[model samples]
Structure formats: structure tokens, C-alpha cells
Target: MSSGSGVQPKVGFIGLGIMGQHMAGHTLAAGHELHVYNRTRSKAKTLVERGAVLHDNPGAVAAASDIVITMVGYPADVEAVYFEAGGILDKARPGSVLIDMTTSSPALAERIAEAASERGVTALDAPVSGGDVGAREAKLAIMVGGDGMAFEQASPVLRTMGANIAHMGAAGAGQHTKMANQIAIASTMLAVAESITYARRAGLDPDVVLDVIGTGAASSFLLNGLGRKMIREDFAPGFFVHHFVKDMTIALEEAARMGLDLPGLELARSLYDRLVSDGFGEEGTQALYRVYNAIHA
Candidate 1:
């Protein structure tokens, strides 16, 4: 339904985690009738109070809505919520749209698309980046994969959550694009961590170093945002290390399938694995700085 047509579509949102919660809020604020479900009932309290319908499960949400969007964690969660016996696919109306915003396997995205098609539903894999801050600010970058027509139909809804939304080919392309994004972030994270460590070891104030370098060619979102967080030791989960590790694993597996070797991604995965082993898995991706600190110490 067009946002400008004065017909706000009924929107279903599953997964009320850090980013998803804010995303659903934006959708609600945009005048859509939002139906929300999360594993944790308490997480949906505010949304429910604000007029969002609370559903018992993903299926219930899908059954009651025109567009179902999932931003859950993990491929397994995506699979369970969309393909299980009582999942979205079973309950969503024939003409309803399904958007999986979770960063998941391209294969799974393709599978979901195929299954949705057989059921007369339109499915799109539209994974997002920009972290919790982006979600909260409604400025995420959404990379979508599916029919161009479906993308157009979903753009108004997607716009409420993201500033940059692009249709990148069909079925699984968004996920493939997300994998590339994770690969680049993997190496850049290491660089950001090491640069901070290097500055501190040389007795230069790391924050000052960041200020200078942040204005130059070396500047980047990671360098300015996560970089400052690293310096401040703010390890809160804008994007969890556990989640980043999962993305890295997916990228590495995809690379292996294509006969590609990505040492940077491999190294990042290994380092994040180390953090997970050390009980820092729940921390933010910026916690990779802890690895450098521990090694240096």
C-alpha cells in the first residue's frame, strides 16, 4: 500500500530485539497499524501500549497483517519463524508481502523466496546495516533482494526504517550484499582496533589520534563510530560480537563455496571466537579492542 495513498497497510513485525524494536516503532509512527510479536513478551510492552497489536507468535502476526517483516537473529530463527509448521508462510495471506530483514544465509533467502512464491506470497530478503543507532534514528541502509515490483511496493514501508534502500537483483542478492558488507567490516574492524592500540602504545592520546585521522582519507563509519566506542570502552551491543561472528562465519562459508580465500575475514572470525570463548560474546563488535588489549597486556 502506498504511504501517500492514505491507505496505511497493516504491518506485522517479529523480533523485537535492539534494532527491531526501534524499527517497528518507526513503522507504527509512520501511521501503519503494527502487529508485533517477540519471544520475550515484555519487550513488546511499549509498542502494545502505543497501539501496536500484540500477537502470540509469528504466525498470528502474519495471519493478521498485510506485510510481515522479520528482523530476528540467526538463520535458524529465521527458518523456524518462516518455515515451521505454524510459521509465517503457513499463515500469511496469498497477496501479503514477506520481508526477512535478518542477516542470514543466501541459500535460506532463496529457499524462502521459492516457498513464498509457491504459496502466492511475495518475499524479499532485505537485510539491514547501521546498527542500533541507525535503527533508533530510522536511518538504516537496507539492501533488498527480490522482484523489482515487490521492492517498489515495499519502499514506502522500508523508508520508515532506512535512509538508503536499494533493490539489489533477485532472491538472495540482498544477503549476498550483506555478506560483502560483513567481509569489508571484518577487516576494517581489525584495522580500527589495531590503530587504537598502536596509538596508545606510542603514548599519543588515542582519542586525539582518532580526531585527526577521522578527518582524513582513513576516515570511515567504523573508524569514527566504533573507533570512538573502543576508546571509551563502551562495549554495549550496537551490534553484538556474537552476531558479527555469525556473519563472518557465513561470509567465510560462502567464500569457501566459491573457491575464494579471505584471510582477513578468517582472522576476524578467529579473534571474535576468542572473545566468545572469553565470555565477551554478548558485547558489542567494538569489544574486538579487548582482544588487542589483552594480547598487549
Candidate 2:
């Protein structure tokens, strides 16, 4: 739909995981007609109680929505949701907007955009950052890529879910931007874990050290937030470890395609690989602290 159409879009959301549930809630709370679906119907129950229409599958959600947002797990899951039989593209209205907010492959985003265009649907790869806290607080950073006009039409709804929203460029640009985000975060996560571990090993109070360093040159959201989580040994999934590993792999693949090598990113990916191999895939990225914690313990 065009910007300034003065119509509230029917919003459909898929993947009601840790982040998506809160995002859909914000949209509903903002007065959109909300439709939703998830593999586990129980996840949609809370939204359904709050006036969202529950659909059984992706295609049904698309049919009922003027704009559809997806926040599924892996690239393969993204493909299955959009390309498999009875998918979003199959049922989306001609002018409906399709947004994939999952952190995924740039190539996959490009493919979805192209396929959506073929169906007269506008698709944006609008991946997000800020984890569960940001999702819950409506403070996410949304990087969007696709049609500029479509981005404008989608911005009001996006603002319900994010404070920092930008139109990066054409198709797949958002995912590329997110890859850059993940690359920077990968090394920082490693450093945050190492720093806190070092503090404990040196017999310093890690929390006080965090208070000191977190205000100085070394401060960041990861340092302040996830570092605190680390100190408490809270390994819950704000952003899952397996998902971070997937993001790192996608970033490294993109880097390899450009004939570039990133040693830090590679090293971080390897450590996360260990976490996944050790069956901590469902845990938060901060669980990396456990590796360091165990070594020093």
C-alpha cells in the first residue's frame, strides 16, 4: 500500500518466538488488526487472548494481512515459510507488503524480494537487533532494504517495534548490514566474556569492574547488559547461541565471497561452535562466559 493511504494495515506475524511475540504485541497494542501463526499454537495464545486472530499457517496469515512480518529461525526456515507450498508469496495480496525480520543470508533476502516482486508483492528484508530486551521495550534497531516507497509505508508499524530504523538500500541490503552488525558484535561478545572472566581470575569483584569499565572507553550494550547477565550466570536466550553461530557463519561466508578474511570473527565463530556442539545451542550468547568461567574455575 502507498504511504499516506490513511488506512491501517492488517498485520500478520509469523514465528512467535522470544522476539516476535513481543513485536506482534507492540503492533497490536498500537491499534493494528493483528493476525498471527506459529508452529506451536500455544505461543500465539497470549496474543489471541488480546484480540489477535490466530491463523493456522503462513499462507493463511498472508491472506488475511495487508503486511506480513516473519521472524523465524534459520535461512532454511525462512525459505520454507516463503517458498514452500502454501507460503507467504503464494497467498499474499498483490500490493501487500512482506517483511522478513529474521537475521538471515543476504542472498536469501534478495531471492525473497525478487520472488515477491514476481507476485506483485513488495518484500523488505528488515532484520532487527536489540535482542529480547529491545523487543520487549520496543527499542530495536531495524535495518530495512527493498522498495523505498514500501519502506515508508511500513515505517509506522516498524516504529512500533524499533527506535532506530533505517532504509539501508535495495534488496538484501538489510541482511548485509546485519551481517556487519553481527561481525562487530561477534568480537565484542568474545572480549566481554574474556574481560569478565579475567576479572574473576584476578580476584577482583567482576561487578565492580563492570561498573568501572562500563562507564569508560570500553562500554557497550553488550558490556553493560550481557556482561551483567554473565556475572549472574543467567544463560537464558535473549538471542540464542545457535542463532549467533548461524549469523557468524553467514558473515564469514559473505566475507569469503569478497575474498576477505576476518580473524576475530572466525575465532568467535569457533568458540560458539563449541557451545553448539556441547548442546548449549538453546542458551543465550552470553553463555560463552561459561567456557571462560569453567576454565578459570
TM-score of 2: 0.97
> Which digits, one per residue and each the tens of the lDDT, describe model 1 over residues 1-297?
434467888999999999999999999999999999999999999999999999999999999888899999899999999999989999997688999999999999999999999999899999999999999999999999998888887888999999999999999999999999999999999999999999999999999999999999999999999999999888888998999999999999999999999999999999999999999989999999999998322
TM-score of each: 0.97, 0.97
lDDT of 2 at 142: 99
Writing each residue's lDDT as its tens digit, candidate 2 over 201-286 gives 89999999999999999999999999999999999899999999999999999999999999999999999998888888899999
Candidate 2 residue pairs that clash: none
C-alpha local distance difference test of each model: 0.94, 0.94
Score candidate 2 by lDDT.
0.94
lDDT of 1 at 51: 100
